[model samples]
Target: MTPQEALFKYTLRLGDNALIQGHRLSEWCSKGPILEEDLALTNIALDNIGLAQAFLKYAADIEGKGKTEDDLAYKRPERQFYNHQITELPIGDFAVTIAKQLLISAFEVPLFSALSHSTDETIAGIAAKGVKESRYHFVHSRDWCYRLGEGTELSHSKLQQAIHDLWAYTGELFEMAEEDTILLVAGIAVDLEELRPLWKETVATVLTEATIQIPEDGTMHTGSRNGVHTEHLGHILAEMQYLQRAYPDATW
Candidate 1:
């Protein structure tokens, strides 16, 4: 693919990951185990949604197409997205959702760190701003992880289960797709393969600090990079896309 095409594709993948995960987190709004945690998750959810919107808009501009961010986000079919499966997995419990956020934010910190220096100026700019958001996300989630993991035996057990269950999905975040090859070769995208070691270390450190154990299941759950999403994404899209689908072209 050409450089423009590569950049747009790469950025859209980033946007999709955040948008879908943001929608998933919003499902917990007003429903978290506590009011503070509820607002915290919602804040993170809004942050992800805002960042996704910016990334999608940047992608659209880079593509030089008339397609707006809303069009790309709301009108697209499930198969068109290229986010990793980690983002779409269910938010099982409070600890589980926090675990998901921790895993995702750990990967994103270094990923966006590298992307901020991308040869593509738009990607670099987006990444530069996003690094701050990703940092804060990890900090917030990490604190929650610690509280739950180190609090009580019951809390520790729940967090440990959450960590073990979600660990498999984390493997796919740094698994680069063929589409990534196009952008990486053109200097517009960082290689996901190279990000793996860093991602693992960060994840390992956070879990360790939280007093959580890493499972050795020796298995990885994959298949979201190609837009084959979990059952959760379809329901998310159904709700997220409802207004758009119900009133095509309707605006506030």
Candidate 2:
């Protein structure tokens, strides 16, 4: 891919991750375990959605197609999306949701921190905001992990089960795509491989303090960087793209 194409894809991937993750978190809107926690998740969802908009808008600009961020977000097909597969998985239960947040936010903290210094000005600006938000997200998820992991027999079991179920997907978060290699050379993309060590340390620290056992790494799930994903992504796209697909050109 040309540098321009690589850059566009890179930006789109960032937007995809945020958009799908924001959608998943938004599902917790009224379903949170408590009212305060419910509002907190909703606010985080909004933060991610806003981040999505920023990234997607930048992606569209890079593409130079005159397509708006909404079009890119609401019009893309499933196979064209590049979100990490973990973001598309079902939010199982409170423990599972918290576990997912803990793992993803742990990765994001280091990922965004490094990206905040990207050579690409727009991406650096976006990542700067992402660093602050991701840090908060990490703290929130880390606290929940402790509460759930040490709270009760059932809670601990559920959290552990969640971790085991999701661990394989985490490997994909650090996988490098072709665009990543190109951007890595240009200093426009954060080195995902470099972020893995810190991510593992963050996750291990939290899980250990919560008395949760980290699962052994097995055959790792992969492919989102190539637009391949679990069946879950199609379902998410079906709901998310419904309005735009069904009512083309219609506006409020």
Candidate 3:
């Protein structure tokens, strides 16, 4: 792919990840363990949605299409989306959500940090803002990991199971594709491979503090970078795009 095409896909990938993740988090509205956490999770969902808008808007602009961010997000087919598979998984128990958040936010912190220096001014500007938000996300989830991982036996067992279930998917977070290679050469993409070590360190520190044992590495789940995803993505698209699909021309 040419640099332009690569950049568009890269931006769309970022936007897709945020949008789906935000949707999952939004499901926790009024469902958090406490009032404070209910508000906190929703607030974080808003943050991810805002990030999605910025990135998808930029992607639309890059494509030079009249399409808006809403068009890309709500009108696209499931197979056309390029979000990480992990982001679209059904949010399980509170512990599962926390585990996914911890892993994702840990990766985002370094990814956004590196992107903050991207040669593309718009991407760099967005990344500079994103890095700050991701840090907060990391800390919030990390604290929860400690709380649940070291809590009562039931809580600890659930948290450990969540970690094990999600560990395999973590490798896809650092997967590089043709678009990534193209943008990396143009100085517009962060080298995800380089971020892997840092992400592992961050995860290790949090798990260690929580007294959680890290799962032994084996086969890692892959694919998402090429528009391949779990079956959950179709379900997400069905619910998310329902209104738009039902009335294509309707506008607020």
lDDT tens per residue, model 3, 58-172: 9999999799999999998987899999999989989999999999999999999999999999999988999999999999999999999899999899989999999999989
Which one wins by TM-score: 1 or 2? 2
Task: Output the worst ten-in-a-row residue range by lDDT, candidate 1.
Answer: 1-10
The number of the candidate with the highest lDDT is 3
Model 1 off-target regions past 4 Å? none
Tens digits of per-residue lDDT for model 1 on 137-228?
Answer: 99988888889988999889999998888877877887777668888877878888888888788878888998898887468887777678
Give TM per candidate: 0.94, 0.99, 0.99
So what's the TM-score on candidate 1? 0.94
Candidate 2: residue 59 lDDT (0-100)? 95
Tens-place lDDT digits, model 2, residues 1-252:
999999999999899999999999999988888998999888888989999999999999999999999999999888789999999999889888889999989988888888888999999999999989988888999999999999999999999999999999999999888999999999999888898888898899999999999999899999998899999999998999998899986679
Between candidates 1 and 2, the lDDT winner: 2
Per-candidate clashes, comma-separated:
0, 0, 0
Q: Candidate 2 deviates by what RMSD? A: 0.7
